[model samples]
Target: MSVPLTLAHLVWRMKHVHPGSEVVADGTRLRFADLADAIVRMAAGLHRRYGIRQGDRVAVLAFNTLEHLQLMYAVPLLGATLTSLNLRLDSAAMVARADRSRTDLLVVGQEALDHRSVGPAVRAAAAELAGHGITVAAAAELAADVETELPDLREDVTAFRFHTSGTTGPAKSYEVTHRDVVLHALSQSAADASGLRAGDRVLPLVPFCHVNGWGLPFVAALTGASLVLPGHDLTPARIAGMLNAERVTVAAAVPAVWFDVCRHLAELGTAPPAALREVLTGGSAVPRSVVDLVRDVLGAGVATAWGMTETLAVSTYERADPSVRAGRFVSLLEARIDGNSGSPGEQGTLQVRGPFVVGDRDGWFDTGDVASLDEEGRLAVHDRAKDLIKSGGEWIVSAQLEQHLCTHPSVSAAAVVARADPKWTERPVAVLVPRQGRLVDETELRAHVAERFPAFWVPDAFTCVERLPLTPVGKVDKRALRARHADGPVLSPDTPGGTR
Candidate 1:
């Protein structure tokens, strides 16, 4: 007889091998053994109370709290699929995701329901969900003391329903099986990957709604790494305190969070926690400055990861010099540049194939990124295919230009968007956020870009702004930039045209 691979085995590991492992969230701490019991009880309660069965979809709208974490394991253990709705999304988008996933039950965290900005959206989603014959309940009311037997499930059973961050366009939904989750978690646990292990206190600053907190929760369960959920208070101060107070050895978040945390630590004159060993960041390109700050201020190695919702969080991790390359492919994954004929120097759309990856054609998933792969299998993503600016039939990579422009002393952030021009069909336009208490000039910025790039690659127009708009996931909102600056530059106080 063959033994099946399922999350049930992970729960078993929690009960037997790592019973004493801790899970801290919102000032409450629980051992793995206790969490396992709660998971089983919650699974039973969900089944008995809501009649949730195999193939049913349970949607959760909440922050990174203990209750939210419990539902991640509980809903799936009952052979039901867990659909995590992005609480940061607007009410319409949240409802659309729930409706698209065919949610049979909706669990709203009490904190979410009480939130000022998210409350209205949750109530709106809940009201609409109830109208569609879906059972809606508060997360606080779902826990049960009832003891019940868990069901055995196949590895191929759908365990999670995830949606893309929709940074470029509308959000798209996808499903991951038990096999995918287990394999991805195991792969991430490897020494070269996230290097998760027992005794490590892991804090996932990434939201659970975002690819299951970038799969850290499950990795913690599998490896016996104590999980420290950040809960709703994502302020950099709070995260910084938790790192030292909880003795976190491993942490993960997007580049934006790390940048703020670095500043916060500098403000407080605090050092990186002694126990902290590594920081995993991605979601968008990890700037070299952020990587250097992590190493210099946090005194930890930075794993600049690259992956998407379709690729199961992060597929590759570059640790040594993260800013230059995306990283070598992790175990159980493969990558190739589309249309590249065996030349590592060739650039094309990045396509990946892996056991856990979702692909549209054949088994290879087109990553929508224009990238080049070195002989060592390292990936250098140039820019998103849609974001590339074509001028006089020559493509100008926006990400490269943006990175170079940000290196300027007075610029804190930069985004390069394509502007329509009758002469060249399209020209590069730059939008920059000046560093605090600093002002930049269009002439100096133009000269800065012209130094490295060709004259044509230099942006035709430059605009200074107080801040760049961001997507729900914290990536620079280039789409919005294009729309806002399509015709001409929008002058701000810092803009050369306005009084500085």
Candidate 2:
């Protein structure tokens, strides 16, 4: 009953069983059978024209599009590892990642080359690779001719490698085998919290460069779901229109995208597309306010999942029960809280062991997140251990402070970072983004936190801005905030106002 679980198997099954299922992109759509044929042709082109050998590293710099999806499948079929470059990275970062991966071939999407910011990054990468004689081709040029057969591939071969967002430090490259990809797809498809099923239409607002859009493309193929890609059009209005036009049943993106979409819908005096049942969010903490807005205004349930590039997109997904606030580990993953003190609701570092999960040590992968396991076995993440601030020899959870700050009526976004202090080793500094047409007073914001949390847990300073800096994948750039404010004045509640 056991057979090799490679992407080739998934492609053949989808092509044969759901040939007519559609995949909608920017202005084009293709059936599963056609998509499979295109992937084959592209694989052949990469092998013959581009000199892509088995086990070679192929890097793709592009926005989410139909062609990008084809490359996602094609590179794996060629027995090569696909490295998706984050389009949001600057030119230097892109060049650094391409070089670090030792990429043998680079494929650039025409749309990305036309982009003002991404174009320069792609050109810089191309220029650097030229010296190495690595082939750089437009994605469109690789999709012709469909007369090639799938190469014999082993399930254990590394098929995908994605770099971290580089927010905390230098981005690290994580590798996943073909079997890892296949099992992750199956696990996601089987999770009821995923809200994915046959005949359903799914749109991934997340970029393909980020964990292959959290593995939606493969999940869609395996479950016979219609895949809808947004391409380079990430505007809230455009995304709302697509949700309505495509009748998307399941969608996934970061919390920021959902917040913008909800705001756009409200501005138009509209509700979520009636077809939308679940909106899956991850990549960062989901604010409770956003969750309430999705339920009350958008008429959809918000499902929060947790994972990273190392865990293969998803390690845990929220349970279906309304009372379960945290996610439960997927069936294939085993999770434990390291350094637990054997107390009720004790928090510790989360460690996971799974077939597809990667780590430097044995089978165990440290997630670098502080979490607590509830009586029901649901895992609630507290914060990143690095993001935790030590003040007066006490640990302060920045996520908790940010959550409280976001509850303020005028605060739309909040980030907390550690500032070196002469007295305490470090002190917490709060950065907040104000809601449109509203201004947040530092004194009042500090009071809001002081009332809710212990007096010592209150932030030492508060900075209000029009917006918070975000990383490539839309998570708050706490590192950038710390760098910007580390040398600035440390305000107190008595201070008139904080830095802008």
Candidate 3:
């Protein structure tokens, strides 16, 4: 039960916990031994078929299904680094990462690309990718290989690469080691059984990106917890059905996924499937309204964990206490704020370090989020700290600008992107999706934001829209937002790079 330092030890632990029992359950199931055998054989195939030597990069682009998890364990079993593509990234970003990591081969799943409308740029890039070949494989193809001695991932070697999500420039690839995976799994393990435990059946909506999904899948394999994998699509109705059908005990995902699921549950004339026990949400903001509704209606445990692909696990939260039903405000992270190094309490950059933390320290990982620690000792992420605008030499948090704008009675949702501005370096621009049929004009929105936030913090222009673009992981796609409104006449930046 001391965290499986080596993946082989993790497998041994899995066999010890549930050996012949189902570790991954789709409509049917595969036992720990079944999974173990499959992973071993696949590792052999990777070596024999593609020359995937230990430490080579093998990329997988697919939804969260049993096969993805198989690849998750198998890649490392072969001592290769698994590079998970942000399925939402258009082909160009995807190709760039493939190039950066120098992926040896790409395995694409049918379900994953079924709905993708990747651009021509990505197509060209994928075609010219230097990898041996791009393989379009399926669950059926993987079931055949089941006999071989697979090499264990070198704990000291790079085990995977996490991409930057590329909301700004092209994505950057960062390596994660086998040691990182083991320690991360350890960190998620409850020091006193307060977090995860044996016999806990978990329903995970996060994709098998070797990031958010890292710890949960192993819960089933390493601790005899049942894993219900929801293949890619996270429709509210589908989520409700899975929660009810599987009687999932533990659930995790970004807030937006749950936001829709919660709405679906309301539509079905029921609260979150009564069988559900605890829910963990992150990857985006949890509005006070959403938190209030979950507490009042569902009555199930809901906790928020903050993490990044870079760190591999939860670094900090405004709230993570067991005693308090603090929806998402508990501070699991311990750190200090030193002036402009970060915001004071309620507004500063969040810098964190811990056993599970992943970062290229020169030492700290600048999360680019502007956050504040409330009097209750909870951390609230206001917005990306990088998204801040310096107007007249003072900081203007776009999140504050957006929050104020959204508060206007006629507004439904609002976002503030950095606009080009030569004088202030940058300024805020409001993009609003008005409440259905109700008209909230740009002038009204500007006046509304100005009255609430400081004048310097006010947005210089407005771009009305029906919805905000989202990154593959489901957070607001600010990169696209910047591109959409970057060239507005209201503010002109000195350089073209800042324009978008």
Candidate 4:
């Protein structure tokens, strides 16, 4: 049997199976049917009143909320693609993305009133679209009474356009089909198949702009699960309070958010929240310390995910081996191992090719990440194939540097990147966030690195930051770091120079 990609099937299933169940807690209660009805009505209204149609791209400029989640259902009702616009990106990037998607409409909510209206690029696109006659809707003014009927979309129609952070470079755009979205929704449902039962509350701290908000909305809608949208203010205290008060059983976040919230809970003399059953962390490697925090502090298990926007959502997950279960980790997705080009315990790139993995090579969609797969099938993401530092033409894993820092007593967090140099072509640099308000200088850090690594592999420079700038999705904003320090002094291969 083949799965047909359509919101209709999901809505019907939910309405029949658990219609009266609360599907979303967007600061208010709404049943799955209530939400589905609203989506159908809006999709109808937009199509009839404003001529919104399928195949056209609809950009949403709001944070994670009930209305934003509604768009996921409503847009596809009209056969239109949803482009979840990142709120943290500049107006310029937004416009560029919108233009790239040829966005025909943008739906924004009232909570966004404090923000300056459509970005200049959006304004320009709006002006251009208006010249050709297009409709842009503000939430307060939209009504579901319009009488327009929407057409059924083709099975393979594109449903969304996801954008990469361009953290390493300029962000690239990719289109996700209705099939991709549907498959992602189903895939994520499988991940939630463990301890979470129907109606279990799952708090989503991840932003909605990313890969269908990592496909959270779809999973909840289909599974008759409840969703708690935490808006844009992601303070650790706020999330911690929600977890405790709401008795949220499951949640998803990047390591950074997890770290901060865990810190807040610890400060309050609390653990990872007794109500929390499982925590899904991704957006980079799962530090050994983080794994320990999730296990010891929260008394919960951790599942690490791997993927990119192009994959629509997760392709790999960290799980424990069934037979051994001796605290050995494993990835559920299809994977293979390759050469490490480093040292012992340091393995090679974990190459993968699966239906969910997307990238173009000759014709394949390579994920561009170099990783390692243990005998147990656990995947440790080493570095971006493009970002790996090559010293004397031998690869120096930057992730290894970060892993070393995470284990250090004084370090709270670290990001290691390659600096372009004339001699080695590129060398490592360590940008860090210290733990417990510790003050760490360059000499002290270099000395620390020298103790663990060969002198040549030591970072040529160290930049201490109050906090690493994060992308909208909450990963360290390495792009911002390079923009600030790309012109910093270069170290000579002949001597160690970052001493002052």
Per-candidate TM-scores read: 0.96, 0.94, 0.80, 0.85
Candidate 1 residue-wise lDDT, 243-314, digit = tens? 999999999988878888887897788867889899998888877677777888899999888888888988
lDDT sort, best first: 1, 2, 4, 3
Question: Of the candidates numbered 1 and 3, which has the greater lDDT value?
Answer: 1
Please give, for residues 44-153, the per-residue lDDT of candidate 2 as tens digits. 88887877867899888888888899999989987899988888888778777777447888898988988876787778877787767877898889865655767778
lDDT of 4 by residue, 275-344 (tens): 7888877777666666666777677777777777766656656655211111112223354545564343
State the lDDT at 22 in candidate 3. Answer: 64
Q: Which of the numbered candidates is closest to the native, going by highest TM-score?
A: 1
Query: How would you encode candidate 3's per-residue C-alpha lDDT over 260-345 as one tens digit per residue?
Result: 67656666678557677777776655544445445555566667666676677554433344212222221233444324544335
Clashes counted in candidate 2 amount to 0
Please say which candidate is ahead in TM-score: 3 or 4: 4
Point out the worst 10-residue segment of candidate 2 by lDDT. Answer: 491-500
